[model samples]
Target: MKSNKATIHDIAAKLNITASTVSRALNDNPRISDETKKKVLKVAKQINYQPNHIASALRSGKSRLIGVIVPTANRNFFSSVIRGIEDHANILNYKIIISQSYDEYAKEVLNTEALINARVDGIIASLGKMTENFDHFHKVLDKGIPLVLFDRTADVLDVSHVILDDHLGAYQAVDHLIKNGCRRIVHFTSAQRINIYRERKRGYEDALKANGLEVDPALILYSNMQLEDGRRLTEETLQNKVHFDGIFSSSDYAAMGALQVLKENGIAVPGQVKLVGFGNEPFTSFSDPTITTVDQRSISMGKITAEMFFEILNNKGAELISKKTIIKPELIIRDSSK
Candidate 1:
């Protein structure tokens, strides 16, 4: 036969064996004799025969492929999670394709649609900010593909998820500052639409109430939570003569900005203005004064998220589908807050 591609039929033709027998032998079905299997393998090696995975998958109705979505590909938290997911997925002989939403609502929807069109066996994702509409996520469920969310997840979605306890993390952070003698604390957060930040803000408020401190409406500030915003807000608070002994920022980047401003203004961290930041990013450990923050256990969250997807995938028809996993956040004490 005039053919450029090598296939199992070519091996069978050379060995003068039935194609079905050759297939069984190639797969080590145990029905084939060892000697015959050895012979089949030898000829198969000579021809460099490769099994057609596409055809096999089509027959079994499984792509053995997973789709993953995150807010940003370059972020430390998302990258760490990707490593965990990759390690676990590789062991099961499955490949994953990843997409980033850059924390945009529209892009996340588009990415979800693209993954669905690609026909992945399952999906794992972290929701982006401003993603109130979840019809695209529903599309995945309608197609019967396994879906799991991690980190910034949707409360309304009834699928597998692995997430950090944001409320407790924030509560502990504020409580620690209070214990250290911070009375008037300022909170810097992102938009209220995002769930994690919202939860963290709530925790901040609850911690204040629990510590017998009145919730000051003027102290809770919302911004983009960027570096410049952090610095600007700190300066603005000072200019406005807002009396605050502590500041809890929702992001490390913002906290760093605030730290710089505090230093320039002769404010001593953990002495004059105790600062606590969320996200134990790498920079948090090496800053001028190490930052006290919440460790979300992102890598472990990733592994568990993938595990949840596989659990549902492996148990396709079973009713044990919708599962939720909450990863506890640990408080890391450092000079900034201690």
Candidate 2:
């Protein structure tokens, strides 16, 4: 009642049971009778008793927690993935701690170190945009924490990854444009440092080449994938007389910006310039002209990423399973593309 803290001893004293018995009941030990466990749980809840996770970790050598790092939680894709992780991890009796990197490499490093210090049994992460150096993850490996990289991954790292096939997704977007008789196409991309972007860029090029169109270096512009970047590039290309009948953007947000600029300049969406984008963001469909884009199956990706973590954990660190799971993306047709 004084409210310093509620402990198991308090619950035991109130219930007139041994602290060990209370502990067992709290843990749902099969040896404890259901009636006793129910009573103990009821009293514990009344007293607002909190378990000593640190002590439990010391006893079992595990925190029964998983650390998750995402580029940005504000984005729908990452948030959906986190939801999937929570749903699956909850079934496994594991709690989760989430951290956002904000697409910064330095912040990612710091967040990971903090997660390791928390004694998390495993980590599920989507690497930041500029994480060229994966030494921090290797440190996670050195500490024997099972790590699974999802969405964005490092090819050089010897870890399991769940990723969408960005190349094929990009090819599909571009090929769809080609099918609609879009000859000259402009590709707006960002963060070429990340493998996903690089793969998407490659797909855009190969699709153009396969369709007997020359890969135009001048048409491809890399930016920060921000709304302003999309607007600026599209505006500049229009002013520079870059004849582009179609525009393919790597992000839906940017595509939305480009769409605005196209409307301001009296350009028809599918009639004059068919447009496509990546990442099936919610705004894609809600926009004036629904955006034709690629769906990365983010929920399924998150589910499998968590499953991969359990796979490594079930092995009990005897072997680091370096498996790669790639999901092929699906193209969603909408009003913006014919």
Candidate 3:
């Protein structure tokens, strides 16, 4: 059976010109005269001709496609980042391929391999929480592909990245609680080796010491920092009779869980126990007492991350110097802390 789909040769034959000329005209090459391009385009529309991107990519050695790997697309932060990347990519006549790692190391490795095999022009990713080894990302660099890491990044990989000042954000949150007379403030954090968590923990400790308070090991609770984890940890703290006047959680979901546990136990927020959370998730504003939180400026972070990726890509990986862009976090005080 013969396919009826029109090709450049069909348009060339109709215009009494060479197939190469039709191809150049379709691509808007300056070498092709405007009159010839007009004729080729008119016939192309009549025949419903569609350009094959794969064949064009093979000829140019450029796919005009970018690969994006995120831990999870369920979060607003990662989605916003992808939007920023897509918007900029569209302007450059490029398309994006997105993959999710779900914070799993093995999945992240598979995504990296898949993107590389797809022959993407570049890759943008955020390191997964369980990713200890960076050999997969290293492979990308070795293959001479542009790689950019945003948010959760690794120190071992010498790639460009954009992130928030997690330490400063934590410090401000803890310090704000201290200023409001929270003496025994409990800090909720994750035990992951990711730099963000470590920085937040450090900020919490530094804030306590700076306020003439001793760093009590009992006051620091480490967990996965999920909603259930926060609820369980808070319940255990109350049951164990741990005395605390405030709680600072590195995650908004965890903070909400703490709030729910406090309400269930008849504890009053701000009056008895002040509370603060990070990540300014949408629910923070909707929750009863409206949780106080640190805004990560996710939209700005996304745009900056995309811009950085393009900068490195335009440089064609010739300059491998590690560049870091740190965005400032904003503290949003609400009923929970007031």
Candidate 4:
């Protein structure tokens, strides 16, 4: 069917008036007469006219769009963050375009370029695991685009960053275990290359020293912070006959693995070997014996990140300072750690 779509020229020709006059009348300009405004509105509604947002944005020099880059959407933590960003953007009448890097450095660079080419007003990003190079981020900064980093951030970059107090959280977890009659405690951690894992390991070591306990290098097992890696580490710990009465893993999945291994070896959690994990993932509460963990306040982190990005966009002043917002971690006591 031929649609009766109307344009400004069509309205002008039909009313025997100039297109500029029709445009002014439709826009309710004070210079236009009330009779002409009514005539234009009636014809526009009858012909089902609609203004093009792309054309409007071109004239206004603003896209009203933001970009978000994350490692992956599969994890609950990241998904929650995205939801918070989206909610805040909705309130401000801005749209978000998202890209996933799958923890690959090259993919992250590509995604960064894509967002920049799309001309988004600002960007929010979480660095991937294998992302060691941050030159791509500098490009965004050089383009005068506001960027905020969350969760896994690059320390070398001077920009807005939001993350949890990982070191303190780990320290508190280990201290709690020690106070609860755990003398020989082993730490299951991830690769120390990442800042978060390094902080967590340092916290564990600091807690041991504060309690006058000798930090056993042999008790520290580095894993990949995955479920399978955790399971493998647990098996190795059991086979090696590591003399430890408790376990503190850097990830909840790894802690869950240790719990499973302990059960298989007839070791009682809290009764024989206590356990604590990080992230407070949902599965932590549903294990055979619920796992104790530290809550990262991911949702709140997301909301705050979005707010920061919007603030930067609203006031891109010369004195605008970059911020590093650290959200505190909460200790959750469950059956795994008494």
Q: What overall lDDT goes with each candidate model?
A: 0.88, 0.91, 0.91, 0.87
Please give, for residues 142-234, the per-residue lDDT of candidate 2 as tens digits. Answer: 888889999889888888999999999999999999999999999998777788889999999999999999998999998988789889999
Tell me the spans in candidate 4 whose CA falls farther than 4 Å from its real position.
Answer: 1-59
lDDT, candidate 1, 187-270, per-residue tens: 999878777898999999999999899999899998878789899999999999999999999888789899999999999987
RMSD to the true structure for each prediction, in A, is 3.4, 1.6, 2.4, 4.4
**Global CA lDDT of candidate 3, please?**
0.91
Which parts of model 2 have CA positions greater than 4 angstroms off?
Answer: 1-3
Q: Cα RMSD (Å) between model 4 and the true structure?
A: 4.4
Sorted on lDDT, best first, the list reads 3, 2, 1, 4
- Candidate 1: where are CA atoms >4 Å away? 1-56
Q: Return the lDDT, model 1, position 43.
A: 91
Worst 10 residues of 3 by lDDT: 313-322
Give me the displacement of residue 13 in model 1, in angstroms. Answer: 8.9
Off by over 4 Å in 3: 1-19, 33-54
Q: Count the backbone clashes (under 3 Å) in each candidate.
A: 0, 0, 0, 0
Model 4 error, position 224 (Å): 1.8
Q: TM-score for candidate 1, please give it.
A: 0.86
List the lowest-lDDT window of 10 residues for candidate 2.
Answer: 313-322
Better candidate number, 1 or 3, judged by lDDT: 3
Q: Across residues 1-338, which tens digit of lDDT does each residue of candidate 4 receive?
A: 97566678887888899988987886579999999999988887877777554554566656778889998887778888999999999998888898999988899999999988777888999988898888899999988889999988877999988988899999999999999989888888865767788889999999999999989999998877788877888888888877788899988888887787788879898799899999989998888788999998888988999999988888875668789999999999999888
Global lDDT of model 2: 0.91
